[model samples]
Target: MGVVEALVGATVFDGETRRHGVAVLVTDGRIAAVLPEHAVPAGAVVTDLGGGLLTAGFIDAQVNGGGGVMLNDGPTADAMAAIARAHRPYGTTALLPTLITDTPAATAAAIAAAIEAAPTRPGVIGLHLEGPHLAPARRGAHVAELMRPLTEADADQLVAATEAIGVLMVTVAVEQAPPRLIRRLADGGVVVSLGHTDATYDDVVRAVDAGARGATHLFNAMSPLGHRAPGMAGAALDAGSLWCGLIADGHHVHPATLGIAIRGKRGPGRCFLVTDAMSTVGTEGTTFLLNGRTARRENGRLTLDDGTLAGADIDMAASVRLLVERVGVDADEALRMASAWPADYLGIAEMRGRIRAGLQADLVHLSDRLEVKATWIAGERDEA
Candidate 1:
């Protein structure tokens, strides 16, 4: 019953196919219709986008900071808002504010902040707790001294947090969190993901059985695939039910390996793109601190002084470009990896990540060169 606006002329990629000369009608923050250009209502406010490509906005499952602000700096609603505002122009309309390995107090603060911020922050889909519970041997960029096993108390707190905050994703090492704890978190509606692990294939299989449905930044902090062993990396590729998040920056994963992951993974579940981005993403800074150590950004990659990979400097638009121009993924599939697949992985596909009637009108408009022209979150243009 609210105002209806039509987005016209651009090619609309509706999460499945790209259609030409169509108009997307949005009413009351939801998609009201998708029709031929000629069918747009006579009185509807129309925004013609020339020949740009309009698709679902990118959804990043891991974002630490942006706009010179890191989540670890404040762990407050204002900090979350700053991060969201900073990334909105880069084509990310929704994201999980990731808290990397930190003290228990810091973790709790981040959780509380995300819960408080989600209702007010349009781009904040949820929070991703990347660890305190992880394998120290595989804890890349995380403080080794802070790594610990998941306790019953920890599990209980997570369950309660999930109840308070919808779409809570916890990335843990399978070798650390017992199968029972994994099941408990999953049953309580927490997305349990395997990450920072050196677990063997068998260990990963057991974790999968207990509802660990995803892997965080595959092949980076985890054990690599061996010819005979097929460690955590191999298990992630082999597990048909598991979704793997890939950093498509061409540094974290080579294009050849990215191609293999795209071709080899059996799905219902598929490999999707995640920024695993840090404070340097949408800002001018070339350095930031992670757990009291400085991570320098150089040559489009973030690394510690010791040269361990920290996070990434890539944004959603750049990742899509890499997939299309370098990795040879079709443009539509590349867009889906940045948008729809992440939505599906987060279990929010029905309401977002697609262009359809009754779905939230979250869209990104891209120029022919694949650069971000503009983005809309829930039908409102982000002016940032």
Candidate 2:
């Protein structure tokens, strides 16, 4: 048997439900078991979490930048590692280093960096290319000039990327990427998502039929849910197979609006929280560059000079807290949105999203108030 350690003194939520007086056993960087505290095996090392809640670490799929490093600014393995480190303190154990609306060459560089980093960087799971193939009408902070239709060559490149990285997610407008192309990418193992579009309800349904798995930051860059015209937002809420990424920063979406969406969201694919964080997270910097334009961070919002929202100024822990406190979400469900739901959306739930036996020992310990006190990735404590 490998070296065994028992984590105790906290209420445990094993992704599905909560249990008290249980000790989580870790061996060889995987969960060994979750049994009663007194049932801990003989000679196993013990560490008390000091009265808190232990749950699976948060998994974010829409992280743009962190640790003063933007993936677009530095599409290298080191930058990806830096971004992961920046978010770890905030309870994010794994994240996709997102590249937003950059050139084709830049996208290639980001993919190469992700392939290079995935083996060594446990936190950098994959890459999220969130544009250049999006609609100019809803280009929030993306360079409109760089936005273009998805070509066969672009589709080929994205499909090829899926073979190299653990996950390759591409966000495109339905108008630019037709159902056929979406089907091709999905068949090639890419997690196709809809965003930055003026697409109609029919457009979204066609994409979903073509295997588009999710909506990027629902109701922000996509078309709104109108009573007469049910746009992408309407389709997202109505579609049972599509996971919606919610930016619960209280700026991109209102608390009440998020509450209603949470309550009305369809099944099999619920709304999950994503940070959409920028380089300002875990830093004191008040401003950063988004495609060469200045994005100012003030009043808990990140926006361009023209007042266009750039990305989010929040972290995963704060996002969960916002949903629970402001949006009136149950604490357990909000925690699921931050961890389990995103892991399921990324198809990585079998690996690290839960505290079940045989899963990776990725965990976060939070105070009764939901603030992160410490985190463990692969059974190792994050001292940074």
Candidate 3:
């Protein structure tokens, strides 16, 4: 009943299979149909994509900042919008504006911001609170002093946050957030992910049993996979229900290690790519402040003065390309990792993650070589 538009001239991957000679029809901000090119409605407005690949847009679950804005510095709706806008050019049509470990006041502000922006910002889906509750030993770039045990009041606030934000992902360490608390958060509809942890296999098992559905940036800040210990990384790989986020940027993870993890990972809960990006992304800035510490960008890597990896400088398109070209994953599967898998991890698969009829028309136009050319969020082309 609304204005209809047909996106044509590109090979379309509907998050499952690729098809040629088809047009994706959009109406009322949702996908109306995916039909043969010649069958487009007579009155529909048609936009040619110029012979690239049209697929579901990338959905990043962990995004710290972009467009020279850090969520921690200003946890506001505008900041969330800016971050989203920056990534849109790189094919990320949906993302969680993530907050690194910070004060309780900052955390509250981020929740409020997400609540306000979730409805207005098409690209911002929710908020990812990466921690104030984490183990000090594995606290990569997070201020160790700020890391503490999850309090009762904190749990209550987080549960209340889920009601408004709809998808609040909280990363915690088992040592900081107990299994009982994990269950409480899960019951409150909070997506609990284990991260910045030094937990052994048994510890991770308990957390997984308590409904911790994911692992954040697998194998980077967590315990390594030792033959005798079988730490969080091992448990993450062994557990079929735990979806893990892998930072495919070569600096964060080695290609050989990534290859091994991808091949060895089990079913139902696949290993997906996450940027774990920072403020420097989509900008030419050389450095930024993280928890009052300076993180410099050099040689395609972001690192603190002391040489600890802060956050990635890569974008979603580059991540997918790395997975396929360097890590040896199938191109389709790599794209799924950036789009479908993360949407599934956030429990929004039905609403997004695919180019199916009835889903939101969030799509990306990428060249055959995997460079992003344009993006569409909710059926509107992002000219930014």
> Each model's TM-score?
0.98, 0.99, 0.99
Worst 10 residues of 1 by lDDT: 375-384
- Listed per candidate, the RMSD to the true structure in angstroms reads 1.0, 0.9, 0.9
Pairs of residues at least 3 apart in sequence or in different chains that clash in candidate 3: none
Give me the displacement of residue 6 in model 2, in angstroms: 0.4
In terms of lDDT, the poorest run of 10 residues in model 2 is 375-384
lDDT of 3: 0.94
How accurate locally, in lDDT, is each candidate? 0.91, 0.93, 0.94
Candidate 3 least-lDDT 10 residues? 375-384
- Residue-level lDDT of model 1, residues 58-163, one tens digit each, is 9999998888888876788888888888889989999988898899999999989988988788898779999989999998888889999999999999999886
Question: Which TM-score value belongs to model 3?
Answer: 0.99
Error of 1 at 196 (Å): 0.3
